[model samples]
Target: MSTPVYEKVALLGLGLIAGSIAWACRRDDVAGEIRGYARSAESRDKTRKLGFCDVVCDSAVEAVQDADLVVLAVPVGAMGPLAREIAPHLKPGCTVTDVGSVKRTVIEEVAPHIPEGVHFVPAHPMAGTEHSGPDAGFASLYDNRWCLIVPTPGTPEADVARLEAFWHRLGANTERMEADHHDLVCAVVSHIPHLIAYTMVGVADDLSKVSEKEVIKFSAAGFRDFTRIAASDPTMWRDVFLTNKEATIEMLGRFTEELFALQRAIRTGDGEQLHAYFTRTRAIRRGIL
Candidate 1:
């Protein structure tokens, strides 16, 4: 067999992203050994039982000790403390990356903690289902997905290329962007959608008790789709909203304005306004290509 792309990769947080990475690395021979750690003992055991990693450690520091590549796969809020804990134990030349949704906050929190010789490459994989946890991951999750690399201002070009290649080998298309811009773009495109889904589902739940069971039992596909997104990991979504507050709030304001305009068109029986609005949006999508 050919040599693995990496000697040993450490994963700090064996959730959906971490588990999917482990499976992909093993399938593509990207890493010789995968060491992983989760927040709880039950998760560690479940990872081991599922064959998610070669070794499971009890602590972040222990998991990352000799790893050539360390990927933090926890919630955004946990990145800083985990980075501080693992930095002291990281190998000198190891490359550390993350699969966070927001790039700016993570780089701010994680970059300063990395030691002198360690390389930090902040990345966000634009891929995931509403489901989470190790059980929810599969080897195919990263296949053909776009992974954005947001390197710091002074980061070396060679380091960035190497990290980009790493994601490519995992079956991802790579792009580079400024960390702050990435957060704002994701807020408008990804974050705001999830927030709207959550809101729509919440609205349904809070309706009059007269139709409570019928809401769930006779739900249509559109409402069901909102419910699925609303079921996403609460802790992760909470951190996402909390950490990326400004962008989300700004996007939400625009969203509400647009929604109110649509509502007005319906209330006033203005068919032409609704038709023109949807037509303009469809043209915008056609231009995306």
Candidate 2:
């Protein structure tokens, strides 16, 4: 067989991202051996049965031993503790990375625990489904997606490039970004949109005139899409909002301003203003397409 990206890779959580990474590595022949660990016994058992991991260890320490690359796939709130747990056991020259949504807070919390020799490169894979768990991951989840590699200052270029190459082999296009900039960009592109979706779903639920049955029975595409976004894992999103508070709040304030303008246009029967606004927004959507 040809050379793999890493001889031994360790996955620190058995959630959707981690499981998907393991399966992608297997599919691409990216790693010679994949070791996995999860705090939940059920998740560990499920991963073992899934056969994505060559070995599922009982502890994080065991899983990361001698690993050339270690991926922390836990929730953002849990990443710091997991990093501390695996720090001492990390192999020198190994690359440690995480798949958290927010980068600044993750770098702040997890960077200190990385030993002097181990390289801590924080990353966020811009790919996931509303579904989460060991069974929710597939090899193609990251295909054609962007994976931002937010390496800390002074980290060797070789290390960052190696990670970028690894992600490339996993079918993701990689881009290097700074921690703070990454957080701000994610806030605008992902965080605020999810927040809006949750709020819209909640508003529908709270409308007494519309019964839940009717809401579900006559759900339009807009509402259905909102429900899909709002159905994301609560704990992960909670951590994302909390950890990325400043950037999220800044963007949210801007969002509120735009919302008030739209509300005002509707109240005043300003069809021209509404049409102009929608036309511009539609162009933005077309750009995305």
TM-score for each predicted model, relative to the true structure:
0.95, 0.98
Clashes of each: 0, 0
- Cα lDDT tens digits for candidate 1, 1-289: 6467779999988888988899888878888899999998989989989997999999888899889999999999999999998888899988899999988789889999999888899999988888887778788888999999998876778878988877888889999999879999999978998988888878877888737788878899878866687888999999999989989998899989999999999999999999999999999979974
Q: Candidate 2 regions off by >4 Å?
A: none
Top candidate, metric TM-score = 2
Q: lDDT scores for all predictions?
A: 0.88, 0.92
> How much does candidate 2 score in TM-score?
0.98
Candidate 2 lDDT at 43 equals: 95
Error of 2 at 214 (Å): 0.6
The number of residue pairs in model 2 that clash at the backbone is 0
lDDT at residue 27 of model 2 (Cα atoms): 88
Clashing residue pairs, backbone N/CA/C < 3 A, model 2: none
> The CA-based lDDT of model 2 is what?
0.92
Residue 73 C-alpha lDDT in model 1:
95
